[model samples]
Target: MHLIHRPDIVASEITPPDVYLDRRRFIGQAAAGAAVLAAGGLLDPRAARAATAPREKLIGVKKSAWTVPEALTPYQDVTTYNNYYEFGTDKADPSENAHTLKTRPWTVRIEGECAKPATFAIEDILKIAPLEERVYRMRCVEAWSMVIPWVGYPLSELLKKVEPTGSAKFVEFSTLADPQTMPGVRGRVLQWPYVEGLRIDEAMHPLTLLTLGVYGEVLPNQNGAPVRLVVPWKYGFKSAKSIVRIRLVDKMPVSAWNRAQPSEYGFFSNVNPEVDHPRWSQAKERRIGEFRKRDTLMFNGYADQVASLYSGMDLRKWF
Candidate 1:
């Protein structure tokens, strides 16, 4: 297997805003360096950014304040790859095919615990909570990763308007399932109407996001079009794409993955290098690039900020 190199960027050595390195030129150098490192097997997996990275870089507005987490940076190297499919199924197809998906007339359904069940247009959501660009690592259960600069807002900000009742213990997320536009659903890889869930606390976590776009552009249909969820700490599947509904529930709603593989897909799918998946060891994952492999970080390197949320619970059993 071809092993990719971890992007080698020191926090202190970040390029200042005043110095603009041509993206085209930088891409060439990075590619050549990755090839050399892969051939020589000189890649240092431990060279990933410090786990407790500065908050400014993770959630900063400008690229200068942003230093991508190692697990996600290599995504830029392989432009043709991504897990999103409302755009199309081929790993490299979404970015190109997603343009065909129209996002207008989209509305999010709010149901379950709130006193008033409401359906609001996508435009109204932007008014509810303004968007912010958050660059985060997206780790997949398949052992591949990406560093995405997402455009979204805190889920909590929107949840507040729904006014989830005291009994609301978990939030259920559902994706749009239109066979006419989303041809992938026609396949049987997963049950129709992809679904995901999160505990009320996790859904409300400061890091959790209700993403609508990426890289300073409206979301490409393949990248979950109208809207999606981004939970950096968990495996990518937990973040449902092309979201259509946000239901406040009292119990753990059945998630698509958990329903498909009860033992393998847990409710709390946080990244844990020590706890191996039944089918594979997640100790390391490949970042999208010219053969760069890096050690997986605990909580996808957000443990310091999120560990306290599950203080007394047994994570191993939860998995």
Candidate 2:
């Protein structure tokens, strides 16, 4: 769905933080007692704490043509209800524990089949391109969804700076795994330095975002601070968080999830309602903040933009 421009309105005029926070606090309190009754237990009391987290305003965030017209999921829900396994398995664990993460002095290493291989500081990465706010529908494999206002430029902008060789057919992303800060990493989850990958074309797609912030603010530690990948068409897991390294390779790199459960998680994890996860149905999803369930869409409603990438391939098989 394309975004409708409202020249009369601006980012600052969107929903006020206090209003949303108060509403979120009420819901969080109510959910604590009625956890099983609220959106199948997706709501948590820890989400209320997200309102207290400090955030800096992001300036010069231009609206993008790729945004959807859906109402945004509240910032509290977006920040607290996350699947960052590096922090912990519970949805609220990231928000509660990710405060230990240190974002500064961060550098993302670019290597492999790229000729201009170099490491870039977080500051340099932010300066690579002007930021744009793209409101995208994020569908998780667990049959949940959210409309997040992601602020960043296209991933292709950064990839171009590295100058990938002709043989660079895939792009692999690696996330930080510091046991001292990220307590969950000390245990055997999937693997250290969580890895995810995409085809060269997918990596270069205009919809593929190298995200830096959300809700017109610097990214929260729980929500992949410093840098992250956001592929809206694919399931949320495809968007690796707290990224530290990007590699260009000739063959498909094994992703953390795919390696952990090859039968359930595929290499190309496009949001296909037709392909069900081993334990759950992918036909419907509960959008955060809403009570009713909505039918899951092909490519999470971005089929018009990304379906052609898999024209001849069997998504069920590839999935």
Candidate 3:
């Protein structure tokens, strides 16, 4: 019998069993602190923002089979260490600047090659399908990773409601880019209303999550409040946040990163250890709270589920 080669796992990177089990308690404590801050009268801008935009517990969050069995990153690390460029370029920028984002009274416009094209309110979108908790490994293009418990339904559930036409071959997603609310938008870091896209089939895949919440509560402003897309197989940048528009079209849409730096960022930003980023190696990644690094997995360890989508195509060429 041949042993399976598991390069992604390392002895030093293995989480202690006790630490894995205690994650729930740690999360509970974080939630308790958040609750107290939400009670009001906080001096800090961040805490005051938290008071106004309190994250409610997402009711009926069913456990999903799609979750991984690894230890989760701490709640604090996941929320604070972010790459939301619309807020700022630094890792801590989003957590500090995104507090000004207004999530309520939001609407997502669904247009293009679909039979039923219409704008849907955030509340109406939530009612479209029951929420499920999927703890997926999030790999960032910047060579960092995290295991987050995201609460959302399969994107197909909402896609089906709009009913795509035969001509719709790709799906394009656009994020909110108000300069007044999002201070970073005033600068020229990236083009306004950040855009991302996926092949029609990938958009309809069960793994493509239309995320609403994280850590069992409504998403914090920094974590892409309102709604976002989570494509587990691709790098984090491919998952557009604070989505405002979704359009189905026949032609491939130019994604924001791809348009910004074609030589660096690709449209199909799949996590492949073989294909390294121009500036860095994609072979290894450091988990947010871990000291040691682990080998990056092909398609972020979801190869069995998503590899077929790229069959017969030269990833190096498309990449």
Candidate 4:
């Protein structure tokens, strides 16, 4: 991603002001050559900036059938249209309001049912698994979509290192909640410290990605910078952003949306055209930056890789 000095930067030249942070962060991190993006299916954490990254970091990254050759969604649309309720309910609120968030000096609190339950700085987290780029389709529960190129390593690599106990049935993740930095947190929109959870097998699936960045740049402040979860097959909301903690447990964990309105949002929010939302049909979705509606695919077209994970389970009931 190209860096610019001011918020009034031309949309054609660099990321928008609200999406991009101050120039000092770019210059300082760039000079150090440590700012790198990670992939999977989540937003990246800028606080987890890399001061030093391997030159050939992308060498191991590979393209899968899941990747479509579609041109990427414009940087402007992707940054402006968002649903980070922590920032605001409107799509543009995050871009317009998330500038004050400080990503540096970040720490991930890892706990619950793991052999290694220790806090990890962003740098140390990236070290556990080599970074790789994955271009995946992001299907939101609202039936909107985008194709974002994310950079990060497989979550399995880290989970393996942490070693979950046999009794662990689910994994829970929480986003940062700093009212001082994020203006929207002060409102009772959904819940403070947005939380999302995944079943143990789902979390361990090879397709699950711990996103560190988007479009090959350290995630912009509005895009859940620092760290987020990115599960391609599930609705975008399942990929919680600005993560601060993770936990392993035996019971199904409650998520923000599901907790607020379980009838509308289910814990196993896998993308399925057949299963319509209570208010709308899920058979089709609006791709961001495009006018035409596209037929929704089951598991966002990742059925081949993750279909078996829910083999005999009743998707409708679980959803």
Candidate 5:
């Protein structure tokens, strides 16, 4: 039995499933079930959401053991519904306004460690690497979740070229700065330029991705456009969008969310249902589109694979 992630369903709002399976069977059965329901005039909202969703490829350097089906929610449903605006309202509205902006001639400045610290043109980066597809469950700080079919490669592969120094302990990421291109940059909602950081170990995690595109197409100008990071373990905000700079450092660089409210966002923003955010409960999340609620799983349902990394530390504090 295969397990497919259906992002359009409001998982938390629904009753828990009686059984679990691998990606293939889950998606196939769910689709079949939804088809039957639709014929009977009882349609699954998620199925409707999936009906409008774009198909994307989740790539990996090699075929992943954890690959799931290509089921996706709509791009507007995903991007436009985002709560990641650094300088404006963190709702879906900012994304609609963002479409008017242009995204090109972008440059990603790479610094810290390595023999060569240089800024690579967006065209050069895309040309150098081929994209692959990988289906990953995306957990957010807001206690909501989604599964994304991301087209990209392991961030570690790119980091290898930069070469970190022995003293480097963390990697700091900075998003694009042009208010002309990003209207959100105009306000002081965040720190002007959004910033995120990851420990050396976290950055090298197999799940950490350097994404280029999604939904079997080039990234929409509003959806980070050129490149971005997709760290499934951390909350979505920690995965800085429209990235423009990456700086390697020996100390922990201050991040936007952490700086805004240290208690809300931590350096290690791993999803822990037990560790509730100040404004919300992390124990359960309301999956988008679906009216039902679902119970939150440890590490957003990846605890079996990643829990060992936090064996002794206090997740309640760090989260």
Candidate 6:
């Protein structure tokens, strides 16, 4: 029942859900959408052309309350133009080299201030909540964007199931550390085992999704396969991928990027154009597959929905 949002836009402006929710219009638009699916294609030197995960398998998944009324970035673009540093720092490194990384035989250890501290099988994680599709606009810190059809469930579902203790004020996520397959592990690019965190309330927000797949298919290794977090209102880096640990604690957890350069990257990380990156203007973003740049939005356009979450705090200070 909860709706998802971008940082600067109102919920109603998201894909015309009202039209789709209507029985007659839904059928008409769906038919129209199907016909237009094949013509558009884009190639990025930063990406690759490869077979995508089975999007057909997701036909049955329920749609989330919101979507972006726009064409998706080419699947090849989403899979290859990735920021997953585990494989390498280059944009195409993930797609080209992540196959060597194993995803099966995975387990996520949940600990810290919770009634239940347990380790769950990767498959079991999928069973915790029913998966659904949310077509969201992903705005990265680098000023580029993509519209991704992510399949997952609200993060609140898992937090509730685990029963976070009252003392738990923040949630920290830790990514896998497989030096054997992840070549980037050898370099000092980032502290190994990348870590990110969210304030407890932020983690519990309805828009915070724990992603398992994309475009209806199980996740590709380069796309944070198996497991990751998708926080639509924040910059993409806040959504830690290939997670292995979820810990609840009273204090805010230090994230990799923020720790490395505290002055540039803040813990809140809400996408706000008013607050420019150290070296560039964030007022406009270059969406992948597009020739023209569009103005960036506050909270990446979800300000109306999520701004209240930080009501008393200064976004400029926190960001």
Please give the lDDT score at residue 9 for candidate 5: 62
Which portions of model 2 miss their true places by more than 4 Å?
1-44, 47-51
Compare the candidates by lDDT and give the number of the best one.
2
Evaluated at residue 289, the lDDT of candidate 5 is: 62
TM-score (C-alpha) between model 1 and the true structure: 0.75
From the highest lDDT down, the ranking of the candidates is: 2, 3, 6, 4, 1, 5
Question: What TM-score does prediction 5 earn?
Answer: 0.76
lDDT of 4 by residue, 160-254 (tens): 77788888899999899999987788988878789999999999898898877776667777788878888999999999898889998899999
Residue lDDT tens for model 1, 180-224: 766667677678789899999999998898887777666655667
Per-residue C-alpha lDDT of model 6 across residues 103-138, encoded as one tens digit per residue: 889999999999988898988888888899999889
Each candidate structure's count of clashing pairs: 9, 0, 0, 18, 24, 12
Q: Model 3, which residues run further than 4 Å from truth? A: 1-53
Root-mean-square deviation (CA) per prediction = 12.2, 10.2, 14.1, 11.0, 12.5, 13.3
In terms of lDDT, the poorest run of 10 residues in model 3 is: 43-52
Error of 1 at 238 (Å): 0.8
Scored by Cα lDDT, where does model 4 land? 0.81
> Model 3, 111-207: lDDT tens per residue?
9999999999999999999999999999999999999999999999998988999999999999999988998899998888899999999999999
Alpha carbon deviation, residue 136, candidate 6 (Å) = 0.7
Model 2 residue pairs with clashes: none
- The model with the greatest TM-score is 2
Candidate 2 lDDT by residue in tens digits, 1-319: 7497667776664666675679978677555747644644455455334445568888889999988999999998898889999999998889989999999999999999988999999999999999999999999999999999999999999999999999999999999999999989999988888999999999999999999999999999999998999999999999999999999999999999999999999999999999999999999999998999999999999999999999999888999
lDDT of each: 0.76, 0.92, 0.91, 0.81, 0.73, 0.86
Clash-forming residue pairs, model 3: none
